[model samples]
Target: MATCLASGLGLRATAWSQTTDGQTQAESAKADPSQAEPSSGDTSSAVKSDTTTVTVTGKKKAPNDRDVYDVSKDLDAKTGTAADALNKIPGVNVDPSGNVTYHGRNVVVYLNGRPSLMLSGDNRGVALKSMPSAYISTIEVISNPGAQQSSGDGAPIININTQRNMPPGMFGSLSARYSSPAGSLETAFLGITKDKLSITLIGSYLNNEMDSRSLSQTSVLDSTDATLQASSSKGEGRSSYRGPFLMANLQYDLGPNDVLAAAFNYNRMPSDSTDISHAVSQAADGAVTNLFDQSGAGRFVTESAGLSGNYTHYGQKPDETLKMDGSLARSASQNDFRSANTYLISTIPGNTGTRIQTHDRRNDKTKANMHAEYNTPIGDDQLTLGAEVDLEDNTINSRVFGPADNDDNLMVNPLLTDDFRSHQVVSAFYATFQREVTPRWTVLLGLRGEVLHLATNDLTYRTKGNINYSRLNPSLFATYVISSQQKVRFNYTHRQQRPEASDLNPHIVYSSDTSVDAGNPGLKPQESDAIEARYEFNGKGLNYGLRGFWRGDSRTITTVSQIIPDPQGLGNIVTQSTRVNWRRRSAYGVSADVSRQISNKLMFSADATLTQSALRNPQISGVRSATSVDGGFSLNYFFKKGDRIFASYKRVGKSYTGQGYTTGSGQANIQYSRKLTDKFDLELMVDDLFRQTRTVTVIDTPLLQTRFVSSRQSPTFMIGLSRHFSRFGPMRAPAN
Candidate 1:
């Protein structure tokens, strides 16, 4: 294999009420909307509402600073998870492993405009894949965030808003879905709105399944371009997960201008997986030097729980508020893996003997966060001040055993065993101001200061280290109106990405028979400067927009591999991979998107981006650049009785890495939904219609060259049934 490395990695203000031309305060707010606000700021134009007071009217509208997608009407919401719905949105990509990216940059996800410990921790992938999407009202994407946002390194932000504002009484939904190859899901939602108290509950049971295969070839070449050793392998794997998830949200109106909210979530997942592989090694003469077959199986269980509370107080003055939030979460996992290697041919002594290996690993993580922000009106402008503290504690224990050199008894392998612990703390403070300089012009300026402390301990190696860093980030956002239908906006910010505890572990971990992965404690954090300009036209039933962006980064982190002598004293050499920091990197891109409502029943939307990225390092001969193109398009048809049909296709572009590059991949999906009755609905969905989702990695180094292709079995067909009921009366569409 290509030695794949694991890098699994705010509200400011409603603007002061203003009137321009013949527009009223409500109309002006609707037209421009407050652009970038802190996550902890509750005075934003799109702040969450209590379930008892929601109202939606007329056609939907989007703010100038961010892109909003309404998924309550999408077919996927009836049967799929939040991850599936996000992958279909233009300019957003979610890989099969549940990692999310925006325009090829890293992303951070929020729930109801606030950070969630479960969504930001290591189990984020699993949680996103399991959480039902039926309750989602809209998703907002912010490409260039403001300093008020506490996102590390200026990462893009995605906020998910659930349905809110009920008329009172009780309302809920129940859904069951089944897919081919033993995959199924059951979900339930309950909401109660009585007087000043609002309660929401969600529960789900999921059984996820997957089947995939991989083919690869690796070679070791000498200075004369002759292959010293080569190996080829083919592997197939199957895995499944069974899980139960539960969540509860409570909101109480302390008074007309004050509110208190608390949320709790818990989930448990038990999984089993198996893999089989066959390999043959050949020398320069093309003679088989060794042959072996390997089979492996694993059983794992993971559990996570979280609790959060928030309090908001609105001042008597308009656009004035104060908010405080606190959250705590814990997650733990236990895994047991066993593998056996049977040799059929050998040229060295004792090579024909069978070898058995066993691995036991446990991981635990705890997170705590606290945030407070105050917003107040300053003359015709708005000012926001905020402070936040975040703490994380992680522990990992691993033990591995293998056959003894002289006997069949298993012996502990110290090189593959470790007990690691890490603690991290972040404290930040920020200030932001928004001004209406002219009738048609508005600007927001902000600055934030942050301090980070990280400490790690390796019990097995008896090694310890401490890292400390501080940064001051600044941001700017400005908007100019050319006409009633056209507007231009600009943004600039500073961003950074700190190395994770796992990335600085400094311990070698086995990836496969011929490869190993390790971390470097000496790695530095990556920092970048980013800027963007966008022009948009909104008129009648058609909307179109164009954007250009550039980012320059220092200390770029990427994976690099090298040929190393086998630590096990095996005759064959192995590939050892680790993360490294490059001197600098730069990327620039342009994007365009258009949407047209052909009729009341038909709509079409499309988006595309062209990006070029370059990297520089003194160790390399010259700077290298790679061009990438990615795009997506979607079509939706609405029928009578709330029936709908949706179709979409998305492609992810190829980009350059430190030592290698990956190929592009795309897939098509279709879904159909019908109203079976006044209170019941039926839906069907098919993913990877063309089965074109596949990727290839090429690693070319002076001494080692490898090519690996991975493809997942596509074509999953799912059917689902859902029922919606309410006692207070039929609710209106979700808020925009």
Candidate 2:
């Protein structure tokens, strides 16, 4: 099924206590020097015996295993969305399509230390692009997740912390942004609290228009290693996204240390795109064979809604808590596509005609989950136990229509029509123990066991299948304090990524007349083992960290493409692609990050990484390895009256697959934010300053080879205005 699974979505309450207290910790350390950790070479902890107190503030916080970056201090929070803000953070990249990565690796996302259906699977990209950054407080990156965290393909985790549910008061904010090339965004939020209850509501709408261009060349080779047929094509397209998003949260204090919470969220987005392409095909003798013109139009709509409830009880002792939560979510999507292809010149008889094709697809999904967790202190150590269960159901209907025999009427193509239904159940149990091995050393050990049951029915094919599997995952975390200002951490984890619903369905779908896609129902899950070590230093006005990571994966899933005959018996060659499990793969990388406050009003930060990745399979070639480098930097200057200027640039490294590789891409952006009044703010920004972002891919195989390049050059000029208000008092100004 199309399950929106968020690892530990409703549990993992301890993450909040450990990661969400940056401001609180800073305040405590400021108020009392004794509350701060003493380090031999640290200047921030310096204090006189009887006289003055010193307070040092930083833009980010690192507590043992994770790094938390304050989002409100950046200008993007005023002019952009959460996706835009994430692109500015070190070691983090949010691509034009809203895919998020850390150090060239996929990352699972969470909201406020808990998993949310909206932030899982395909929905995550849409949410990140549509959600306003004004509602965010901080962004947390967990390099090596502990056993307590949900695992996905052994990738890291990123948590987006939103500002909500404040003390007894009435608070709210409204923001609007307009951009050239036809784009607009609007956000509104309101919160009310009294006595022991708090309620929050957030709403946002985004309408963005963009243009894209792509060029591709494909060649078919003969037994003598000579090209038999070759084709080249160029396509131009325009697309837009328009959507409204709504969310509500409720929290109530049942007693001194008890709380109850409920949350509801709904989102709907409709998108459309149109593209035209011109292609020419040549024979081995370089003779023109066909000149083709193709035009396509597509429309897609997606809607989702979810409801969740939680209960928490805190014990008298610190870090002791019991939590339980459950959630239900439903999502639906519809896709309609139409395409027309005309051949101006052809070698075959009666081939200079126009062909029309249409596709209609609809998918509906429902998911329910229950989770519970308990954390307690044993002497000076900590122990946690948790359990969770999830259930998912999905239904999909797909139909393809092609030109009828000799007539203009359309007929349903049986080979490309299908009805699919799937149901899945997953259960997991985990335990983690933390202990202080010494005054300067700490360790955490964890183990998790999970069981999955899946069943699918293909009514079109009259086939039914059942799959079940179980596995154990383990994780370890250790940290040693090297000095007052420096420390070292080591981590190890095991993770798995299962095949999604689309990957498990055995239906052949046509992307174009010359391209087809399908799935393998017998594919195995991918598994990975990862280890990492990091060294961190917090100096007077400079902070830096270096991390080295190594990972090995088995049963790695990779795409494989081959030349095949056209399914319609049209005497044409087509590309058929599917996913398969590779034998092994390994990757190792080193990354570094540094941040400094150059002056009272100026701040600078930079990061760089070097990676060596390799893939191996027995079916074809030997081990293939690639080395790549990635780097980025940002500069922020704060002016009087809460005005700020921010500039940043980032580049992603190249990536490789079994038969192909994709080149890297880069972009630069600048923004200006000004406090116009006590309650109003203004912002101006420019994105893709140099318009240097593009994707280039090459695939070489024995029978077929292809090269493709895609570029989207939309340099955005945006202006935004926001306002803050509170019924109880004037809202506090944002941090810089």
Candidate 3:
């Protein structure tokens, strides 16, 4: 089971006193005509500052080219992670598993306009939560992205921009929270910046503990046409997690057009859990029959670190720019489990067995990329051309051990120890042209070509294999202004999906009494063709949008059970079974959202999505087609100077969980915040306020099949206070 919660707040502060002073001096000189003449006389030797200013009253204005989505203005006061900030953008959403989707598709996330540590494996969630929202300047959502981007499963492109300027100063924030059933968390951040150099640091710690209880019942029948028995199971589980993170960034401006930036990030997470279950069966003769009891405890620890350096050259003809970025990251996790079970039979003495298992895994990844772009203009049109080359190498190692009851000694299999390595290289070239065809009509043309090569090497007991694959993807988009306040756009793209290292290895690490999972050695990539159309309308104080999209994929990958056992007597092993052009899927969906400021202190936003998808596979009989529909709505109100109120509700209809059968879930949240003083604030939050129980039901159709149903419910509450401090100067404008 996966729990969803945001981590502590970590902020990176930079000092910009010199830049601020420059701006202030520039404004003063502009006001005094006598001083402006000398400043303009020496054009070649004078400093030319890069800055802009705008005034805001009661209405919103269009964003500038350099301005991404503003965090303070775009997100609700209750948002926690950067993911929450990104989701507020049009055509952007984050799934329950923490995967970000754009325009109902997948997208990659970039930090500071470069590929960072967040793009890899399971670290995405941790990275998102550890980064504080206050440190972010803006988030950009790119739908039909260019070819210079990394190629992967289709996802919207998201770029997170950090604050670039603060007075030569230091600032930080502290916060604490608690949940009724989930747990408690505390986080803090601090940073310092000065002159032409700036350094920002962040640290956070979190502890989450959860307790749950459940009951289930099942009936089984034998192949001899005889009713075996009915069984009832009751179980309780407790789970807890403690995680800490530290990150630092340094930026030095060599000159007005040259800069060097370095960053380092580290995270450590430790978790422990225990589960106990007992089952009792009633015989056909109405007597107590077989009884079984099982219990297990497990501990897991993961640590990851990343380091990267970036050099940028910003001065060149046609406003050219070149960026070189390289990064290395490594992570490791260890898990241990201990279990004991007793089986009772009528004729023989009860059999008792105990097993202890441990698994240790490690992953190391390195990536390097270079990007160059040149911008030029022809007549009234603007053209930009860019190219990028990226290389990534990843390696993984795993070891597992199991021991018998009285032996108290663990045994390792020579064949089970395995090492897997994967290498990928992507080269892309792209160009974008924007032209003002007419006063009321503007056209933009963009094209990108990408070539990808992936190679995987597996060294394991059961199989030794190597596989390579290449792919080419293209995309196109267009937008037209029907009127001054209305616009329409259309986009189309073809994308590819490559299997991860863990999914491609042919190894069996762990198994249960009834179910076993094994990896596949010969898996192929999947391709998708997607298209979408959208329209937007901007009025006095309201912005509204509607979009429709359709996606079709080939060679879709799905896990299925194998009919035969492994020849090596690995017991009932389940391997990845490929359908080989036997499966086809198509989905279409539409979404609409509206944002408006009802008054000076009140704002409202709501969005809804509805989609229908179908799967056709002849090889798998009795498979039913399913559809999913989900949406959410939110309202926020401000009052009494610095107080805020928020309410939100989300619903997910019956959706397939891949194990055959459908599940439904929903959640609601309410929060309030008040400013106790200029530097202090307090907040109260409630999660799952409705206490809605999420349930999943499974039905087996084959002979001797059984039915099982399970449900889980949790509700929590939290209260917190936040404070700010500035060492060098008074706090500047609140971070937006």
Candidate 4:
């Protein structure tokens, strides 16, 4: 399926707040009515009351700088991760694989103000899938980060704010949820606050399993339109994961003007998966020519831990502050895979050739980061200066064995093992200034300079080298207020994505019986220039927005495939895929979103987007592009006694990648929730009502053409119950 239509009428009333930042709104007064002392920027060294203070009102409000999503207001979930919640936000999209895109461009995710090691690489999707959304109080979507944010702000950013001031007592929450595919989630939160110290703890566990099946067809043809080889196969696989995630934070008030904090996070995931597929090849005359069957099973385990500390001092003046944060982390992973295969000709009743292979791989990595920023008021403008340093050390090893009793076949593919090591260091400094040119206009500009060094070595191939590159990233942001309820913003930013260590490892992986994949150690980093325009309107209980963006990439890394002659020679060849530096790529898109309250009991929202992307393959001297249209709508109904009913449907269009083009599709969900009591609730949900979720891929070339489809068309129903208790008193509606 390349596209799907999803439409639904919703009923329910909701409100949107014009103000941003919980600390700047009146809700803080409702959350804390104890006449407590001020916390944010109360830079008075000596104070009488040592009671716990709230920082929600910190610094001065930045009215024209960023867009903020108050998670508490827009979503109320008994069970779901931040990734799920983020998918519901306007102008944001999260693919089935949990890759997040904002305005048609990739974004960097941060916890508080620091980079989250767990939210990068494969770990990003998994960690976000398991992370409890409740831990994040707010999400700031910064389209143009200032120099003070340095490297992190270079690209669009998703900053998760997890810290909240605690009242003068101990409190927390406990929750458990179960879903389809035999998946379960459990979480606990505990916080304690004294006169001068605040302690918070979070613990969670996830046990999940999922399965899917697929069928595919492939044909190899000559330039004369004659089919040389045709094949078909059916495949299925199941995967399971069990893991524990934990975090702890400690904050102490050194005085009224300064604060000290430390935090630690850890997680371990153990997984198992298996797959099997069989295919038969036919000649142009429909005669069975060859048979191939393959099966594999594998186990993977990963572990990560991190510790960090922070010191913040609010200067003894308005709009002045100094903050320093540092963190260190370690992550390690291992995989063991085994497979068996058989190949035979039509004339042979028994297998002509057979082989068994075992593959083992391990990776160990360590990361360290430090950041410092200072902000002060200069005349009517604000200036920020910042510096940061990041370091990474990684080691990987892979080994393979074939046919316990065979050496002839092994020698054909002699290079079967390798040890790879990589080291990376990055240092950056930046400066930013924000000026209010007039009563209704604001301008901001920043520049960041970064230096990066990468070194890699391959013991098996005796190849070693070092790479050094540096660039200056600059950004500009401006806001023009048309009125109290209307405003327009313009933003331009430059960002970079460095190639991962895994991408630099020079090792060949037999991904399939007929195909192999390898990395390119000489690959360079990719850079992007992004520009966007946005307009927002909010008034009379209505919220609407429009946005457009264009992003261009240089030296983009892409995968290209070619037929390699098999060393066994028997007049056979195999397909091999390798990564290389592509010439360039570009994407641009426009989207709009509107949410309105139809009545006291009915609310409706809708969003649509159109995007086009193109890439230039320097190796092939060819260029290809694709366009997609995606959209979704939702309805909500609120009844008495805190009861609600909701319905929604979303569709995503096809995506173009270096490998091939993917299909587009969507799903529908209907849910009803009832408040059994003031602190207890029940929910029933029917998801994928139409079973429309399907995956399809296509690859076309002069000599080969292949198409594969995996239809995950299954209906699921779930029932959940939850209980909540809070001594901190009334819960304010989350900001929108």
Candidate 5:
């Protein structure tokens, strides 16, 4: 019987939050004392009488219980970062490798709700532009996640929910920004609460400078005996970046139903780059043969850290949770390649030749996790049980140097170095059950069981040892309440995705077309089978929703393009790379959203999404098919007593980067705010009003096909001012 229900769910997951009337029902549900009506720089407490509102995850009942987009009043009139306030939600998107998509899939970021260490690369855009979105307060977009959360393949999660009381005393904020074509400047500092324990600190300083120029033209066609070739290119570039960040958080409230929390973070990035290039080639009675010239310089660095903990009880009606976490990270990079080549050969002699290359890389990572949850009810139904444990460690080191004068650089190969390591362990058990089969129908069932173990050491190339995997995930949900404001839902899930540790470490990195990117240890592990359906409607001020989804996978991991044989043997020429796999994939989607209030003070909203994807590889032989779309719209207006005005529009289309396609983008934004008294406030913003330029195109399979273009150096006026203070001091001691 599933091993006695997974060994009684790990012996009740460490005694399910050790009770005491479930810590007084989780401190009266975290004292949500019906709050609302404190605007003018809010200070909480107000709501003359009850306005009844509660809809813990949809199904009727919610005439407003806080949150309709409010990131600390748009970070007191915005200034940037946190992906510029998550691009004002409404179908979210953040590409350029900072990856963050919604409506187009892939989204998973959380910070008070857990999971966040700047989600990889470019430090996730320098930790979302150096924090301070007024320390966020709500930004959830779970796009079909249920099964009590935590899975891979299904994507879309984006939690973020910070700022949880600390205002009975001290508060904080300080900001600054400037940009003139990437000659950037940004500053921030924030602090909070001071009695009964609570503290938050944030800091950021940045300097980015840039200049780039380019021009290109190309045409080539060769059919058996038919041939033609023509090409031209010119380029110039300069780059510089300096990033600094610090984050701290602490909380203690051990008394009113125990609580304690701690966190710390740091980031530093240093970068430099310079380049120049010229080229020309022609054939087919156009003569020119070939001519080329180039130059370069580069550098990089990164660091990260995190720690976490949580505990709760609050007696009886389902209330109990416990969690612990830890993390650490490090990075280093370098590249210097000086090049000069001229060829037109009139006799294998003199044409000028020079090349020098040096490359280096280092990385380290560590992680730990623990979990617990409990809520009981059996007869009238309603139950939840959980258990979890996870651990990870990774390391990579690389080095290379070439050029000792021709002969293919004296047959290169010496300095080539490599070292990669990995270790992972995961264990889980879960159960959930809910019922009320009528009274408007409701039913939920969930089950999870997992075990994974992996190990590798001194992996210098292919083949190493140790591996084990196991899984059993299941879920089902249904809900109906066709009146009093409509509602309907259905869901099914089975998800899994494991194989990260640099995709099974086997070291070799450094590419941006200087080729040399490797990793593959006979990779495997990927699973998914998901389904969803939803419909909702709420009146009064109107609100709407519609959703649909389907997913299937059995071994899926993409990014392929190969042509090896250059393990420094030099002569046999061949290089063009990228790898990772366990093919076979499928996807389907639909989405819609609407919100309105055309009267009173005006309001509006909109959202849309569509998707389709397929890939069934045979070592990939062109089985292409894909589609994706995005949308966003917004409007808001309110006059007097605090003021407000806003407008927005966003769109994205043209997908497929697994070697092809990209060219569709749009953006628009406008804002206004006021309140020049009772603690100050003033703001103004205008961005990308109509500026667009984002491109992508790739195809290196069966050899040769490339196109790449990039943009995002944001510029477009902004101004902000803010001030607030209330009973500043005393309240410490809320930790357990």
Candidate 6:
């Protein structure tokens, strides 16, 4: 199609051309079809009735892999830990509590397309918090995972690709940073690559301290709908952490089509600190019901080590492949806690002294996983088959000494002294088919079947529980190209969330002066059915995406709080928080992301998400619904003087959970970098610009309502000097 000439006399005309097909012609005049004939001789003719248009494209269309993004190119991230860098990703959010979510869905984290034993269980956040970002080459957030992924359906997956085939020869980088709230961080990366072998080492040392103050106001109502007690407590404390982390990977090309890789991970937090807090309570009539002053201090020492191996056999066919991965890991932790309270009010019956309690916990965990996948082409369709086996054995020894009871015996709660052991095993098999049914349509179908065996024993309580179950999960994905530059996708999957060992422990621990925390042994696993639809567009230099998702879950586990008589029998009342399963839970949301480069020197990007979540249970609060909105933006500028400035801001809305709710806070970060030399750079960074990222929560329960707030992020300024050495090859330059 072509357009020419304005419908006005003496109108100025400009010429433009776009290629509709591989054809070109210069027509001198319109002729009757019956008399039309080609000129046999002189092709030199300079008369035309209409101007022809043609367009040439310099590059092929971008690939349809919407789930992958280049870490360095997409996010102008400086040298920082993975936790500090993840905030720059689109549609990814990390809350104040170190929980990572993608589009309001729980995200499974992986390493090099496989689950690493180093990141087993609830340690992903810890790994990200300490591991340097330099170890990562790319971060792939799979929004619609297929059957090859052993993870649950509808759940997102984040695969952190390690630095493969390190810059030829020997190269390394060193950086050190100092933060206000968090102490000092020093990290280094060393890589040696020669021929078909590559070995890389990355390590970090961190010594950080966090100080925060929180105020919790609680109201206890009686059966008559009258406030029986009102408790307001304000506490302040500080916790310091010092640790070291090291990870090494070795890769060797066994042959033209096979590769073997081995890696090891180790991290330790051996330093322990002491913290104390005091709380005072009042009555509903504004009287000093309990003037008890309580203080507690705790110490924790934890260490983890793991080793893994992976082998990849790329068959003769480009896309045919077989992969095998295996890993084994062990983590150990020890905790010692003690608290003392002086009753300014009256003490318990037959007692004239304050209360003292001590709790000690020793935990050890061992895990092993083996997985294998085969990828092949079946005619015009692609097929993937995989199997995985996971085994975990955990043991926890706990002992607690409570306050003196009426009989002068302080060890009143027998459940506090228990030895918990848990053994879990899972075997799974999955199959996936991706077929290009037509030129413009693709369909993906996957099915997974798994058998789970779990056993738990409470040696002290003389109780045990066993579970044996099997489940089959099916998923479907459909993608249709609306045009050369636009596409639409739909996906559905089912996922399950089982209770961790800690969630099933029955040990009682006092989290604060007025709060007693415990776990439920009879807790059930949660399962959800999720579906998503996404539309994507690619223009000149801009990318845009919109997605909508909904999930329905049953047996949702959540923290439930209630006012109860002091289990320690020290008078007054206290709040007890425990985990419970909800009858039903559901959430739905829409999200959007945009990336555009306005010019060569400046660029801007933005993302927004909105969600509505609701939960109901007959045993907890009746039913509640929460709606939230989250949005963020960033700006980057590259100056001609070999300098760069990057700034970002994020404002997240409220997040909902069973029995309680929390509101997200605003966060901001900025950085400036100067290129001192081709191999060395100087940079300044700042975090928590607003210094107001706090965890604010509200617990609306049948017997009590409480409001609490705790600081998460603090204003921190840091200066770092980085040096890079590329001996065998030149490296990619930083932003500037």
Residue-by-residue lDDT tens digits, candidate 4, 101-182: 7644568888876777777655676677677776666677776565555453336778776645555568777777677857
Poorest lDDT segment (10 consecutive residues) of candidate 6: 28-37
lDDT of candidate 3 over 572-599, digit per residue (tens)? 1222232233355777888887777687
575-645 per-residue lDDT for model 1 (tens digits): 88888898888999899987777888888888899999898744458987889998888888889888888
> Which model is ahead, 4 or 5, in terms of TM-score?
4
| Model 5 CA lDDT for position 336 | 40
- Counting clashing residue pairs in each candidate, in order, gives 12, 1, 9, 8, 25, 7
lDDT of 3: 0.56
State each model's CA lDDT, in order.
Answer: 0.74, 0.75, 0.56, 0.68, 0.57, 0.67
Cα error, candidate 1, residue 495 (Å): 1.5
* Local accuracy of candidate 5 as per-residue lDDT tens digits, 433-472: 8776776766778888888888887555645657787787
Model 6 residue 300 lDDT score? 79
RMSD of model 4, in Å? 8.2
**Looking at model 5, how many pairs of residues clash?**
25
Per-residue lDDT tens digits of candidate 6, residues 590-614? 9998777678777677889999988
TM-scores, all candidates, are 0.89, 0.89, 0.79, 0.86, 0.30, 0.85
Off by over 4 Å in 5: 1-97, 100-127, 132-144, 147-158, 171-207, 210-227, 230-234, 238-316, 319-698, 701-704, 707-736
- Candidate 5 versus truth, CA RMSD in Å, comes to 24.1
Clashes of 4: 8
- Best first by lDDT, ranked: 2, 1, 4, 6, 5, 3
Q: Compare the candidates by lDDT and give the number of the best one.
A: 2
Superposed Cα deviation of residue 453, candidate 6 (Å): 0.3
